[model samples]
Target chain A: MEIPVPRPSEPAKVFHHSCFAMNTRFSLVLVGLEAEQARALAQTAERHLLACERLMSRFDAVSPVSDLNRRAADEKVTPPDALWEILTLCQGYWRQTRGAFDITLWPLTRCWREHLQRAEEPTDETIQRTLLQTGFHRLYLDEAARTVRFQSKGMSIDLGGFGKGYALESVAVQLRAAGVERAFLSFGESSITVLGSHPHGPAWPVGVGNLFSPQDAVHTFQLRDASLSTSGTAPFNAAGGPRAFGQIIDPRSGRPIEGYRTMSVASPGGMEAEVLSTALLITPAEQRAELLSDFSAVSGVEIVYDSNAGEFVPRIEWKYGS
Target chain B: MDLDSPSLSSSGLESRADRREFLKRLAVLAGSSALIAELPWWSPLRVAPVAEAAADRVRLGLVGVGTRGNLHISHLLNTPGVEIAALCDDYDPHLQAGLARVKGAKGFSDFRRMLEMPDLDGVLIATPLHQHARMCLDAFSADKHVFCEKSLAYTIEECQAIADAHRGSKRVFQIGHQRMFSPAFLQALELVRNGAIGQITQIRAYWHRNGNWRNPVPDPSLERRLNWRLYREYSCGLMTELASHHMQVANWFLGAHPVACTGYGSINYWKDGREVYDNVNLIYRYANGTHAIYDSLISNKFYGMEVQVMGPKGTIEAEAGRLYAETPPPAPGIVQLINSLEHGFFDTVPIGGPSWVPDLKRDAKGTAITHEKSTDDGTAISLAAFANAIRLGVPIEGMMEQACRSGVSVLMGQAAMEQQREIAWPEGFRI
Candidate 1:
């Protein structure tokens, strides 16, 4: 391979801003724009972020998703077009992840949380009953009518993981259209998207920091015009004791994925990275290759905490692509 | 620290449960038995309620039967084995109003005369700023226990004098920083001590209220007496009247008083010829280089009040009673249990090199510090603590120090703002 000559970098000052939305913080670092212009761009992006929050947040009593959650179990509820498209995309990812990444497992999660808080585990009968309220397969999306209906009486959906990626993707689009070619956006530092390249390099070097020592980056990824999503699980805990299931429930078994592990994925789009990260975490190692083969130009890694050192030391156990 | 949401109704901690139940809840709020032992005020709550008898009762006299004084009257009235023996206020209407609320309690226009009342075990001083030192000193001289309302005194010299008077006395002396007894604040303190939020990085506290901080004056002649908090002569304005509560909390959580302070304040919005600032901003520097930033404004009520204890790992909004983790990692120790149950399959095996496995994030609201909505803001329990301490005839071990630290800290801030220069903690101040 021939080495190419590098282009000279701009003497740019980064303008930074952060706003809370989608239950996490969204931060922006804009290069080469004047302070005022960058502030305006950040404000515009924040507006877009909040708009996405209004569409997707289940906790909001009047959000479109909340409205659907209330009415869909009884009738075919026509969501706004934007929300419908989000649901449609969720359905696509649900199928692609082989029923692994589900938005309808909220009931099972609630069940486990309730049991954990009481220092008990759910009985088999209770798990089976709660499972009836879960599963993406139980949802019926009318493509023509732009409506959604639940096959069961208590099915609900949460876009907690997906909303960050989708909002970042939308905001990135807005920023690009507004002539922001070199920028970075992050949601809680777990979901990140970069535009063009680093101010001084060909690619932005983003890192997955050590969980215990967050300031120490354990893994670095060279990214350009890409999105990275890192997700992890230990257990569903309240006040640090009586742990029960993981925060991320396994849609198939109606149980949580076991152990302290984080899955990181880099993809060409924010939504893809977000979807694949959760999907890949739930998919078994024997099946991950099949899952990854479905997507192009994507990479991922799974990190497990090693505690034999008397402290948590993150070690990479599984990785695919580059 | 699993201070779980109680199934109790929101009528507030009025259900007088058993000692074991209270201790269990206190343990959860304070983290451990060792931690609970450090809080001397909590010991009083654990003591069994005394039988209702005049001989065994804690007879307390009240000074300044105004706004806060009336609140104290309510809490003290309900406190176990406590009798409001006397009430005093220079103002005639307040004296009459307070006298009407308590049966068999004598009324007096002078606090000095009230201090001479027979069988008055202690005196509760809710008087204006300038009177705290003299009232506390006179009450101490009368051999009475003292529970003085906060911003301990009008000036640093007075705070030192009050602390010096009460230092080694057998009589109980308590400062009315009620958050000391608040379940929500106790839970936050426990979490911070347990390193749930890692090292203390910074604390930012703010209090915002929409209306002008003023009271309707029945007569123009009594304006300064009624709204004493609005004048620099009587109070340090927002710094002493308002900021002291949060500043006390900051000092308690940080385990140190500020070594120096600087601030800026002005009568920005409400220019009603008030001698004090309508808005104040201050920064207090502790010995460890941690700075506590405090601000108060009466022009906006968007964020009513919050004492945000921030660190590298998380942030605890004490007033809102929520904890927000920085990265919110899942319970890592649970991994050991889960992996061990799996017979070390994935735990030991080297999965074929570099394949995909991933996870993501959840945006759940911050965890609640306490389930109970304490409508009294711990004032009731704090009053109970005062009564119990008097009954025990022992000074609260650290009460005088807490009073002096917060009292002097706010005075430093007030001086810093007024002089437009940094003010160091009062040198040679005794506690």
Candidate 2:
């Protein structure tokens, strides 16, 4: 039986903020009152002008074309301070994740995209070439000039996926400066950040959607000044439809992830939320506890695994209050 | 810690020993007379030199002095006539802490050493779920009175064996379903039994928690196997730990054992090394056609715990400390016909002997009874009764059976959750 969607009696008052570049699927929620502040943050995020944007944006994806196109075309140009900082930050995160979250993997993504499109299997040689030129170490970032040059000619970079969360966090800081105490900002499907508390009390209530069962909500989280992000095959992946590959790609294996039905992360910062949810998807089930233990920012996590009957049942794990 | 009964206070005694001797004699006379004869006749029996029969002061030996056992200690301290004699816990810190809570109590790491105190009158068992049956049986064999915590045993055989042993022993063996002693629950039970709510048809109970148990163990103390509720071997997961309490409530209200019960549970979250389930939902069918639905979760704290008993005439629901009754809707088609009959349908006949509105507007008699606090004073009341019976050498017929039956009630829910199948109690099975 399909139940009618329960909507609030009154219209929800809208809040605005923007940081990440806007596309059909990816855009920042602007929380500040002035549009110009939102636009400036968006520019900083798009050009990797701040290290917060680049360091925060760490994903192996094919979209967000500017960084990938320039690197692939061998365009060595000076960038802004924020962009340089982000690029340098990604290099560190790459090391910490043991090359599991390298951003310079667009060539490998391209190979998978081509093979997926043609319905053809790639040979070991094709996979090897892409892997060689796809590590964070392959890209030499010049901090003084804010210039990025690939040590190997074929290496490329992209930050379309992770940049939104990094940019969202940057925008949240801007919102805090603007004296916005309570707010929620979302960047497309995967990134969401909460500011302050709900007007009545502490903790903003966010509903956790069941990935397989669209009609049901598993649990609601009370978040205050926390960022929440969800990654799953529910949004974009399709076997024979308009969307063939989902947005999240596993850097370790150079493929879109499967197995986990959904993973939602809650943390103090948007970048942490974005990275943990993506990294959690790629990390095998057995090694997940060790992988998650190191990050102090990961406050809580809820994952739904598919059962024999294809039902998604949630498993919740949370750290004690900080 | 010092007080004389109102009856004894009028007559003066010089020293502590003199007062104790006089009080002991008075208690014995009062206890025997109260049981054998009515209050008028019993009062006179206590008029003579009341200084012969002395009730034993309970020297309580506590085992498993941790989170749960701590609460038991606090309650026992408040209880009159209980002297906490010894405390035992594997963790030295907990043992020291438990010893500090009850002044002058001896502390030991091993429970066996604590139980060896010859003066010990009773043993209070609040160990983890797995050790409950063995500890209680040991205490019983030692000729000590036992007060074991809920979910009395981990397995059906253990529950049955303990019940059998308790039947054979002359000592009092009580299971702690403290809510049974709660005034609100007692009132609710009374209201239902008296047909205030007609016949109860269903009961719904839930204890939903947001996060799974994740208390940090001390570094270098990775004894997850010992604190084994997190694993299947020791605990029956959410069913035994939580649902059993409500199941006992339902069983008591229905006044019959369930014919069959079935449920499902799983490790929905916190897929670490723990094998126990994080969530479970069960349905029990009573012999009298009543049904009880129970559920629990370790993922999110949204719905507070509550027990809603539905009857034909009304619904009695209690959560936390508040008891609310939603009376069934007013009889349908009353107002129109009463007005029509009062006015002769058209105001033509004026056939009114008395105004019908007054009868319809009569006020309800307010609440049946009001309780002032949440602490189960019933336990104190029950303990007083048990002490009276023990001192008088009379049978405590209904109390032990009630607790034993509820222990079985707890086991039924556990078995259903563990085996993933329906369980039925044998016909004519008592306690």
Candidate 3:
């Protein structure tokens, strides 16, 4: 069996430019703009992405997140207004998803990755110890001071799952504010936001592909002035080797969820789409609908892979809304 | 050895370690005072020397109070230990305007009277191209230093004459090629010298603007006087005014002037009875087989302006302050595995991770070469260099040569375009 590669869509009457930022490629496409104006707007959007990266990147030693990791354990630390707002939003999502989505899962992620590197599963005792280091409830937020403190040491936040959506949403807002009515912005291809309808169609057509075979679409979403985000698990390592582990760590189990699966969600808000996509992937098949009820106007689908003979077959395990 | 193409084979550095050692040696060689004296103003050691108390102040006279002259006036006013002693312009309004700006400065309708001021240590000639030769010669005759705006002279003979006269004079002679003082360009040059981009291969540059390339004149009778750039008798338009800056950078980086050049130009878009072409395209070939391709137009501002110095390993977009590696270095584990595989060993590669997803898909967008963002485009720094040189009483080492090479090369290109044939560097002309 041959895997197909996706080709670029037909060129539209849009000014499109791409740049590498925040550990992913970000693209901005503006409809009905001169080349000069489009370039200027793209520059503004790129600056906004860089600012987000500076504020949120865990790898950047000087980033605010890194500073919080270093200091929030012992004392209350007031974050920048932007970061404070994002944290508050994360807190709201955590409660809405009933603890399915958590930023404090970094400890569990680090533990699973280390054990997996040695081709061994983490011990139960190790998992329990690492679990002690995680849990959103251990985080304390002073509403009046806009400051946060960790109840336990090693409790950290990684924006890797949500930063792209936030940045894309920010760029989309800036473009709309600048009178760019029809636009499309995407971060790392996994998170995409559209400003308005397509130039020739009523909505922008976006595909949710099988994680292993990216060109094979499991589902498609028609986004009109909305955003879509996808979270998935893969069997192969980053270097293209056959590996048994995945990137999505189950916060409750303190281990990466084994199997091939992908979840895609769409909503008017970029943050809502990102949170639902990640949370639905971890929530039990029967509990996903209840978790998604907190977000209005959201649609989602879960594609689970079944090994038939020697080939992987993708099946729509569950879906919410059309 | 030709200064344009330094012989690299003699260094015998084949391995990366050896090449790094060779770069270290080159750095030491570049630091010597003897070499620094021959380097351009953009070199690392080209800092302003401490001024003597007695010779700290360098009073200057402005010859043309036009657009470029006014810009120089603004920079000079902010420059330390510099005073605007006289302003000269045949146009009464410009002279009055300059006089109004520089409180106590005297005004002159003719530059010769301005050059006659004993207190004027230097004269900055920002006049039209055709008048540059006469003003520079007169400035030299009056025993005053000269800072002439670029595309030095209208004719090749005039360029040679200016150089020849300056060679015998003790006064400093500088040109208005501000990229020489740009911090970004200097950093780019440092990268090139350190072999960050391997052997220099080619340079591609362009300047594009979507405008008619015209200056508004107060009256129709003063058209030639006000908008001299649009006329053949006074200027070569895009080639002299726009292309000269890129050509100067090309020659400065290549370390050699073009041996020959050929080009074609036309007044294609703005057919407003302008004597010079609105578009130009030229290719200059150096002695070492390196080529610099340049083009300019007034029809599209899409590309704006940039000088891309390319080599085998990477490209340095000097204007944009970015460098892109041809192939980015692989992750550390991948490098080790590749090396082990090449050596016929089967090893368990420790390359497992939470899928090493890149922050962005690596396309052609390269990394920024500069650490901090800057608003400077080198003009302010270039003016400071001029003031410092005058105060230190020493001419910049290669300022005149940079001017002559770019000035003569553009004139050659103009000659090539006008005569419909390839033009060689002027024979027997010495800088």
Q: Can you give the TM-score per candidate against the true fold?
A: 0.60, 0.46, 0.55
lDDT tens per residue, model 1, B1-431? 00011222322444434322443454354444356765767776666567778778888898988877877776666666889999998899988999999999999988889888887899988888889999999999999999899879988888878877877789999998888888788778888999988999999999998987777889999888888888888888888888898999999999899999999999989998899999999999999999999999999999988999999888999998888766434222222212322231212111111112123235343777776455557776777777777887767777887888898999999899999999998777767
Candidate 1, DockQ score (0 to 1): 0.04
Name the candidate that leads on TM-score: 1
Fnat of all models, as shown: 0.01, 0.00, 0.03
Candidate 2 vs 3: which has more TM-score:
3
Give the CA lDDT, 0 to 100, for residue A208 in model 2: 54
lDDT of 2 by residue, B288-341 (tens): 788889888878778867788877666666544333333212111122212322
Task: Report lDDT (CA) for all predictions.
Answer: 0.78, 0.58, 0.77
| Candidate 1 local Cα displacement, residue B28, angstroms | 9.6
Docking class of 3: incorrect
| Docking outcome class, model 2 | incorrect
Question: What does candidate 2's lDDT look like per residue over A1-322, in tens digits?
Answer: 1122234344233333222233212233333235565556445444542344334333313222355444534766555566667677777676666566667777776787677668764577877766777777767777766676777777767765467677778778876876666555555444667677644334555555445443234555566788877665342323443324544566656666544445667788887776666667666766766766767756545454544454446555333223
Q: What TM-score number comes out for model 3?
A: 0.55
Worst 10 residues of 3 chain B by lDDT: B1-10
Residue range B141-210, candidate 3, lDDT tens digits: 9998888998799999999999999996678888888777665777788788888899899999999999
| Residue runs of model 3 more than 4 Å from their true location after superposition | A1-322, B1-38, B42-55, B335-351, B354-363
